[model samples]
Target: MATRPSSLESGRIHHQLGKPRGLLVSPICTSRKMSSKGPCRRGHSSSDSPCVENATLVPTSVRTHSENSSLIASSIGATEVVSQQPISSNVENLAVSRMEAIGQSLSARGISQQVSSVILSSWRHGTNAQFNSAWNRWSRWCVQRQVDPVRAPLADILEFLHILFQQGLQYRTINVYRSAISSAHVPVEGAPVGQHSLVSRFFKGIFNIRPPQPKYCTTWDTGKVLRYILSLPRNRELSLRLMTLKTAMLVALVTAGRCSSLIALDLQFMQKTKTAFVFTLVKPTKCSAASKTAKKVTLTHYPPDSKLCVVKALEVYLQRTKPARGQGKDKLTSLFLSFVKPVHAVVSATIARWLRTIMASSGIDVSHYRAHSTRGAATSAAARAGVSTAQILKAADWSSESTFTRFYRRDVTTSEFQTAVLASVKR
Candidate 1:
């Protein structure tokens, strides 16, 4: 009689046969025949037994340890085998289960499960984090008050918004919480929680009391930053740290891109031309995700200023970091890698910190302005340089001219009105 192979031996056999690690093969169960009732027999649940009809191979990684153990036990009396199912169907089923779980947690009953899943799928990871945070806060409040958060009365929601306002939360933050509640709760009196009459009135009152304000009224001078960058040692002479900073700041200024876009720049999608370096963002940016369009950032050679040219700085930096990409299978292909050992791709937050470092080194007040101010500073400088509004809009990826005018446009120079008034009334 032939002896049965252990699980380890089966794994070795599969490996020797060049089978993919993702695929798992198990011997068929021939100890018991299928009963007349169903595919599974008595004393063996369907989930616990591998019947002839359900003996198809699935990825071991997707199954729990106990399930795999059961499969190994059932394969002890084996003869025939079955082919594998496509992995795509299992992955799809996993995604559907997750969506259903989300729908149940959110108490999303106003829409069908399918529609709710699709709606939830549209939210980005960052949006999900924000929504979850807000929901957790709401849930805590309901627990303290002994009310159901998902089915809470309008009075409870209004009281919660009132408490948030009293806590000195800004209108924008409170509005986010309101939107989060609306997402989880069913409509109240035929209107979303945010749009209900009393809730709308309360929000309007809050807005009137504490209006939203632009973060920066005037942006730092771009020439100051460029001059500082140019004053640094030559690209080849500078240390890897300085070169990385210089390259990042130059790209940030010329492209007027957000940190998200900067970090999403992959070498695989980059195109170098005689006049410019063109990067098509393979990943979706905040604006691109909303507009359903791809974003392209082009950095053209600056002939007038060789030292401050983004293209030259980027080329030198890339060459400097080439050896740092690692050897063998561990090599990295990201546009920006960490300067430290075991270097890997940098995150968006790291790029933001690099921008802030450049700003501080260039004499800009880092306390008053955030890393995001780079967008406003660069765009405002372009507008001052007589660049057309259309070009500015296109470069900044803004869908409307009003977006630039309302949010990003700022005085890059000293306030002319204040200077004129002070000069006329000399002390």
Candidate 2:
């Protein structure tokens, strides 16, 4: 039997006091005088319970069975999650709960690992911000329309997308919205269908998205663009500033160098063995170069005496302006600083703007043209020069010959016209 105070001293005790009305007491005791009241966690009596305005001091989370209250808590690291109610077990709630779990999983890894998780999640769940926005709008629309969001057919999504496209959203932006719907894993409200099913149905024919055309600073005729670039203030401009930007873009125009790969290059990156100063264009810096950081990181000026003129311009800009360290020290060391001053490289936007200003000055109305027009012009120039379509593809870094044949290789078909004219002459 449990120990108990003497019935004569304790108001009443069952068995111990030999009284029929006596009851077993909890660790937090109450006298018969205050019998109607419950004992609190701290063992304090009702009149002076040491609580605030009749509230219990012990957290609701630790309340016992008699209180009929719920307790749910999450403990991680230095965090203490406290709750006083039961969690929902419905599918919608479960999906949200799982997302939080995935987020926590990502938070514990390295940056690359986390980025991989994000990409994977996006493939499965639509990670793009634009797509998320579209999903939200559609969700709200569904609620307003009284359509069961869970059982929404693919046609519903298409209808919503059409409405959005008509609202002046770009095809790419609309596509992003459609992409977000791809992440729908389960029915939103759990009617009869899963979200992925609806998504698959909705997106069966929808993945043809293109990125927005970035704003260019200037636009003009191809000839004007070239002239303006060639006329850059030479000594006043960084030495070879014009040459570097022009060559890089020209190379990008002619060769289709990735903006990263092109910008990450220097004269040293080339081979001095070639007469035209040809060098292997390697190391697109979207990711850091591994295994070559120590030896290949620095610029290798060629012929033992020639400093890349473009690299010289970069040195001048660095000494003059003291540009800050960027994501890649080796890559940002490009000689072509923006004419705007303080910025490191001649960015695509800046190049486009430069072309526009020069074209406007050179009597070309370039306002309607785009930076990509320069790319178009390069193909036109290559075709006019009778450069082999294959050579153009090689210069451009195209992945597929078909793409090069379709877009970059524009050799004119003059043979047919020539043949027809010759036949007439012969006749």
Candidate 3:
């Protein structure tokens, strides 16, 4: 509009607005009488006020006739009366479009598909659940101790690990907590707090104090296990359930695959040959995530008369169960399912439960044997049968012999060659 008075234009304009305590002064209407610094009567200007020399005192109702005239004029100078109008819709839309274009260009400029995938994976919920859990535990611990959790000192992390160790947590388990906390703290701090040199040395000391013990497991008798499976009750209600368990246990033993890999299997991954069905593990597994290509395991069928044939068990189970079938993969269909209502994909825990059921039925202590024991048992049996190390390693999907020899290849029956010779001579 009109030129704003230097005194009234500034933020300190209450004095120019009659110093009203409860009223909001309108910015327009310069014809209204201007108040001076001294006490003055209404509709009058003091001799000291600039309005006394340049502006005429008018009634409160007096208004400018021109619709486009300035609402207010300066009392000190003949300031131009600039007209005020609402901004055009076109101008607002153009401004918004320009801002959106700039934002889109900036967002798309440096982001490639690979970079976007990596960024998304970094913050993805599935990958960071462990981190979140670990952080929450540490935060609660910090709260109990009346210490800051997020900016925890390196010493606090070492103490936390020490506490976990004292609670009988394995070295690897303590390290998992450390890794999770360190990863979460990296965004707030430039570096991981637990990875500090002093903290690492503390970890080394802790490890030396309480080294992790190798977990012990008992192997299963493949022939006896098969016989047990076949002898299970074949009543209408239990036949399908036993058959599915038999097929699952046999396939797991034959392939020497982990529960994760077993539950992830689908019909699309299997190719039938003359004597065997080859299963390709194209999906990422715990061990194969870093590998470039998928792995394959072949399960050959036994003779038609043999009751322990994995192929036969699979065929019987497939025939009994009603999996959704189509040309391509049916996402709703899984290799394994619960016999209960609303059949759905079996998780790794389900496989573990099935293995426990099988183990418990065979007079073996189920607590001492886990589902992963299948891999060890199969590899050890192959080794005992004069199978090559490389063949066993390949079948077990092991990249090296250390894990096979140290962990899987346990001498449950024989301690040494002399004991074995004595036993053989006595027999």
Candidate 4:
């Protein structure tokens, strides 16, 4: 009988034959030192050295595409087994690919790997999706013209931006794409793409042509929504779904909190005081980095109306959902849980939908405004009630008054301008 080829020889043949579609092969016999007494760490025969045959095949779905790419690139002639960790979000994968591209570009410049990692780490995770989108578009544009994306001439960059402008993109959105390019491309004339004199002037011309405007000119009255809430039956008599919507709306209006902040509320960080229920956000919010301390939202008892009391509604909701929360370690700790079976923590988008539902039910024009308009409505109502600017700022977690003035400040009475104009005209 003919002698069998060694495992190492088998692996090479397998690799040359090409890995099966949608599968990744794991490397075998990683150790260079062989055991004299018995098989090596991989338990291969002494005659069988580290080679292709020892590799095991795994499904591609087991690892994220970006992670698989990184592992394959790092290993030399051997495919390492990737960890079983679940794939991350699309944004995270995009971030990995962008960093890898940046690393490859820097490697030719004599930059060390550790320093490149540090440089990549400086970018915020929140901006990955935006930067990746812009970068991909720029790269595609460069490819069509047969130019290097990172080393393109200044005229090419300007031409790309001009094309974006022609596509009816707003001034601010185009500026974001510019910032994305600046982060990736090498500096032009010792200045970033955004800072270049020609680019700056081009942006100024664009802004002058199409000025930015606030999303809402006026916000609906909060009293209208409260009146609708008060009309609902007592919390005990209402269905779990209705109660959940009511509770979410009341907390949103009272706290003027964003959807992200609302979803970040966890029962683990909640406290019940003698007169108020306090919730502290454990997850990161938009302002988390700006403020050193954790943000707190306090809902106090409403002496004027027990039925409309947020604290009371919240307590009743928790009591109603107690059975659904289950028990012990597996119990859900999130403040908001889905009202359906197999109930679990709700995402930020769910909170926004609930708010929008409440707005529609209360007769607010959902077409002209969104769930986020609740912030402007509540703050405007508070201002009309003579609440100080400082108190409004503190409650809304706004660091500057300018933010409120530019974005949140709006006429509480909708159609005021139309009413005024129509009233002045003769019938």
- Top candidate by lDDT: 4
Candidate 1 Cα misplacement greater than 4 A, ranges:
1-101, 105-121, 326-331, 413-427
Local accuracy of candidate 2 as per-residue lDDT tens digits, 1-427: 0111111010110111111222223221223212234321112222221110000001122222111101000000000011111212221121222233234334434445557566555322113333333344444344233232323455565666655444444444455545444444233444322234554444343434323333332222234344444355553453444443443443344333444444555544644322233444453443333443411222222221122232333344445534442555454545345645455665545655544444465445564544444554454455444555565454444446776544433322344335435655665
Task: Give all TM-scores, in the order shown.
Answer: 0.69, 0.44, 0.64, 0.69
Model 4 worst lDDT run, 10 consecutive residues: 1-10
Q: Compute the lDDT of residue 157 as modeled in candidate 4.
A: 85
Task: List, residue by residue over 5-54, the lDDT tens digit for candidate 1.
Answer: 11100000010112111211111111132234432222322232111110
Give the lowest summed-lDDT range of ten residues in model 3: 71-80
Distance from true location, Cα of 38 in model 2, Å? 32
Give the per-residue lDDT of model 3 (tens digit) for 311-391: 666666766775533235555445787877667777877987887788678654666666677677666655654567787
> What's the lDDT for all of these models?
0.62, 0.37, 0.51, 0.64
lDDT per residue for candidate 4 within 34-113, as digits (tens), equals: 23442221222222211111110011223222322222111111101111112123211222134555776677688999
Give the residue spans of candidate 2 off by over 4 A: 1-156, 165-173, 183-221, 229-251, 258-261, 264-364, 401-427
Better of 1 and 4 by lDDT: 4
Candidate 2 vs 4: which has more TM-score: 4
